[model samples]
Target: MSSPRPLNRRHFLRTTSAAAATGYFVGSSSLTRGQESPNERPVFATIGLRNQGWSITSKSTKFADFAAFADVDANVLGENLEKLEKQTGKKADGYSDYRKVLERDDIDAVMIATPDHWHTKISVEAMLAGKDVYCEKPLTLTIDEGKLIERVVKQTGRVFQVGTMQRTESDQRFLKAIALIRDGRIGEIVKVTCGINGATGSPVIPAIDVPEGLDWDKWLGPAAKVPYRALPQMREGYGGGVPLYTNCHYAWRNWYEYSGGQMNDWGAHHVDIATWALGASDSGPNKITPVSYSLPVEYENGYPTVDDQYNSPTKFEIHANMPGDIPLVITSEGDNGILFEGTKGRFFVNRGKLTGKPVEDLESNPLPEGAVEAVYGGPVSENHTANFVAAMASREQPISDVWSHNRMLEICHLANIAIRLGRELNWDPTKREIVGDEQANAFLSRECRKGYEIDM
Candidate 1:
């Protein structure tokens, strides 16, 4: 086998600059003469071609062709295939198993938007197979998985971009707020509050026969095999069936078995901003202590039922100690937003707006010369998908590369672990292990079903 390629920073800069000078947009069809061959576009396969996968395909088609698509749910896979054919005017092969997609030699990269439990496994395997990966966040379901992915990226030498799109959107309130904080207009960040809406609960319907096209067994890959149930109602197009009486699919976030509920779901986005502004993307909190927690006893109208059925923390006040003197408290509340308190003033940001005291601070302060550039490597691109394509072509790290993303993911996972354990736990980042507590350490990794190991 050939030796892997090194992703050197200087080399990336040089190539990017040269490409920019030549007016050749990275990954553009017009740039076919730059590398590979004029007749060929980089071929990519997408796993979990359901909800987010379709969006990724729409974005990627501007740069590359969809060579294949994979999803355990045949209904979703077939629907996406038709869409891809219509949009790209290319007939793409379909697969019920992602492993089969990875085995092909023609594919250059793989975009993974699978469930939380499957992210690390498929991403690591794809990287080991010499394909670059575009993986969704939170990058890993567990702390150990994050560490393992970080190691795999280093070992494989393949470019890996985490789908933290907020990092690329200049108009996003959260990203703009961080830029203001890093500019020192907000002063030293003393506190942070992050809120998530709610959690998913059990379904009311009973289990039913599996759908026709779906490979039910494959859908449960790695996850323990359970009886077939209608996909969760929250899932797009979920209708007409005896619901499994348990939340599944998109609602899986509410369950501990499949995801980390709102904590990991929305926390991944908000906490990422907190880490980015505090300049703690490489390390994590020293301690995570839950000050308060509340779970819903019933579901809202049109919302799924609420019960201990879901393992994720629905409501909690988690105080985390960062490197600074002040501690950051991440809380879940009715309103979803992120508030940052600093020495000079306070700033609050959410999906819709960014606001703070002494508003002029934001207008006057510009990001530090190298800080913003270091994170994104250049002027902010309007499009997140375009940024990933550019990074792939220039061989540079994307704004949300695997290493930085895994660090943020570690924070979310640790917060969940602490909440589940219902106690304070010490963390040792250097060792990548939970210090001194065997019981807590057990939560770091999960056992897969028979024949479904992560290939550690």
Candidate 2:
């Protein structure tokens, strides 16, 4: 492997103050002004090199070079290193510990694809280190982490983008849908349904020895640690009859120890759009109730009882009374898409297609020319990563800002809390809290491992 050019951490630290203050809420270009040409491309590091992180980093290579790579799993890191070096024609420094990547002076930004538990810590630290960031969605594991990220963004003024790529690459359908709703084409949407599918379920996975090239401890950063459990890794998720085999990392989502099941997984996407359309992106639901829920294991105080079974709700419909008292249903039933029911019209959309009478009649009773573009805040971007790179140059907020995402994520987190408690809870959108339930409020944040905890 070709060695990376020298990165002087001391040199970087000396200029940290001035560098962080460069560019008035602009991109990392400000940091490279005197050292490199304005036309120079920014250097980046990918912190998690697994499934989603690899996909995002692979595409992001179109906009920036991979100067460094970090992952707790040595196997994934080594494989990504070979592939990235071959594809980019540039050797990158690989580190088992992510903190080393953050210390490098050459990397101007980082694409964080770590677990939901690690998102807030890494993103916040990356921004504070004078690096821009592209964080995967379900931006935080909790509502409190969401607020933490928002504060860091404003303080660091780093170019930030969440992985809600639908905003840019929905072929104008999502934007069109939002425009139609906002334009009153959908006559004040009274109800919305988000079908995200249920959480993955399985019998208790047996704990086993730690595998080679994997650091299970670091993988559980900020999350409560548990015995290593092997999850059934089928060709695909539920619905495909699986030959049972065992894996760990990919199965992290099935456990509440690392993620909030589908609530934060697909919920991150649909909930983001659903709330954005309501113009409640900065606020949250006024009330939340678990209409009905089925789980793989019993829960107490919003946590699973069993040690090794998948814990996310299997089949559940969470009812949310949004800011305007509009009823929002998040469930696994029906088509795997978002449905907007309004007084005047109705429509549905997902990664596959966007359709409904409103979309069909757009040719006749159409929105204004720039409706979709306006939702994007400008012209349509090439893709989500392209938007991140563009915003870095233009010093503008990318399509999915951190604050807006947190508002949406807050609802999903609350949904899980209400479901786990099996009760209705009152929420104050303005205060951003549960009205009278202390138990539910506690789930807003998790107690992080001492070393992994961040100052809030």
Candidate 3:
């Protein structure tokens, strides 16, 4: 592995001289780069130390040295530090505030595993700090945040990899599927079903006192301040208990305030594959209609009528019409996977299996040489985080770049908005506008808490 360009005080000053104009470090560091000893590897920080954050940090130690850890919940920060230190034989510093971790010059990169809302804030700041980033899936909570991230990436020229690890893992099933579709093995593609099953919401529970050692205000961050609710604040573990319905942590996906439910939860992966097969990563749907939907609670314009219960759509079938003749269906009714149906044949794929006539034909006739490699943009790695570390050294774009993911996420956001409004809406991709419906258009962005506004 290539060593990161170590920044001394002078180098940090030089690289950050343009911070005022660009909002982040723009100049290149002058430190030499070469192989570093095992303990001297590039330093990386973990910003959110809960579920997905813990998983990513644990796996990333093989690629980068741990430098700092941050989380709003002090309990998580303390526990994870001991576990990581015991494994690596070195103490990785811990912090409750993420901005403090970003302020350090020696830190080379950061992995952002915060909730959907905090993804944009930490990612933008990390790039500005001249640090490469690995952010969890559903890159943004809203469509406008996606636009902001795309612009910041272009300005900073930092390496970024979304946590859609299916590209690097999955034993090439999704890649092969994309290659088959692109190579015309599926004939003329007419329709697709990206099935991401949904779930119900937490019930109307009374607010409880903030848990001991947790920073409730910082945990809310850009989200609105509500009385602390235990079920939505933490998961089954870490002083939280299981509820009759879904709870937080794993079930944060069930809430609209913190996430996009199943739409962004699983759609970040499958919808991306659907977009890839159609060669539409840089484009999006021309129109969207909510054929059917069932939210956990009543909604006005788009806000939930009640705060005590989960409110995101729990069951939905959204129709997205593309520039091409094909129409994409997103639903919670089918097996959890993606189905590509063309005039000639159809195939199904998920994490466990890939099936249908197309896959069966692979026995007699296979994808040509380098077909899978072509789809992956190059040689595939053993896992996804390795791909990100490789891109940091090569200074090349990872397989899942922000621009394409942003485009795919736009589709997911539109579907969610369509479901929320209970109406069909027209979209102009070129102009990035929702045609004719001002109320639907207003759903594209949101009101961030005043102090936490996206400055970019």
Candidate 4:
């Protein structure tokens, strides 16, 4: 398939603005057409059928038809397919390899919930294969990977949505929050604090035999091949039942090899909202300072020294010097939410609630009509996946567009790098590099393990 021209953002905004003026939203009109016809519904395939992979797909079935499911582990791939069939009475094909799903012409889009390391490769390939992509947050493992995904997205003209659902979901609380900020209810912004909860250190886990029906090598993918490690101890709740310390399952978030611990795990969600409210979606932090942090394992030259346990920082208080001299503190402390502090008033918001004086005052002094819709660029969707489907129908970028996601994610990535190196970093957001620090800049991108290099 030949690559098409990228979506014209300026034209889209103008059109949507005029539609909004007339009490009509651009995406909603076209999106309803799909629901009216069975064949018009986009066909979706999920690439990673584990925790979030299943969650997104389950929610997405409201607007799209599932055509296939893929996972490196056959066991996981099969279980999700059964679950999907039970829920929808639609028996879809299952594949252990994601490439097979991407190769199918019937699939119009792919929901990728793979590990951080694999996001860039699969997203690039899927878009190149003529499928629109809805990828999970912390859209990339590293800064350069974000650049690659951005390039592939623009080159392919795909309707890509990063899984920062706060932009669409969260009961419209986040949208209300942004609207308040834009409405100057908070006055001039002074400081913003993101209280993404901290992570816990893991015990030494011994290398164990790969679990039955698991493809260890395929799971490793672009990450360096290593012995599969697990402790047999089971986690208690959500994403539980699997080994609590395995490097291949839900516990992969604890390792730098596969994830960025809570920094990217939770940070991806909160930081994206914080960045959006700060009006810094197109810009980023100029400096990232590691105020204080503690890693579970030793490190040498920013590389983890041990291989048997979690290596990501368990606790961190990173200070990013953002635009307008605003201090954006990403700390593994306080509530798991965002606090927007400004000259006039302050407010806090999370998935569960939006609070503070600004929120309280809203009852007596309600926001201007259509305030929330204005913040969302149009009428809000039923959910995050609905916004993606709307974008699919309108052929426009979704609320969680790749360019803005990457911009916010760069702050999260730089925070990890700062804490890992135990120093402050000078970042040139425009250049997208660590200024004058070759050694630190080297961490911006990782070399893929042999035989797993991404095809450009």
Q: Which candidate's lDDT is highest?
A: 4
Candidate 4 residue spans exceeding 4 A from truth: 1-39
What TM-score quantifies how close candidate 3 is to the native fold? Answer: 0.89
How many backbone clashes can be found in candidate 4? 0
- In candidate 2, what are the lDDT values of residues 103-134, reduced to their tens digit? 88777889999888889889888888878889
Task: Return the lDDT, model 1, position 264.
Answer: 81
Return the TM-score for candidate 1, rounded to 2 decimals: 0.86
Candidate 4 residue 255 C-alpha distance from true site, Å: 0.6
In candidate 2 the C-alpha lDDT for residue 138 amounts to 81
lDDT of 3: 0.78
Candidate 1 segments exceeding 4 Å error: 1-35, 38-40, 170-172, 203-205, 230-245, 295-308, 358-375
Score every model by TM-score: 0.86, 0.90, 0.89, 0.93
Clash counts per candidate, in order, are: 0, 0, 0, 0
lDDT (Cα atoms) of all candidates against the true structure: 0.71, 0.78, 0.78, 0.85
Off by more than 4 A, model 3? 1-40, 231-248
Model 3 clash pairs are none
**Candidate 2: residue 381 Cα off by (Å):** 1.0
Query: Can you write out model 4's per-residue Cα lDDT over 168-249, one digit (the tens) per residue?
Result: 7778999999999999998999999999998888888999899999999988999998999998788888998799888878
Shift of residue 194 alpha carbon in model 4, Å = 0.2
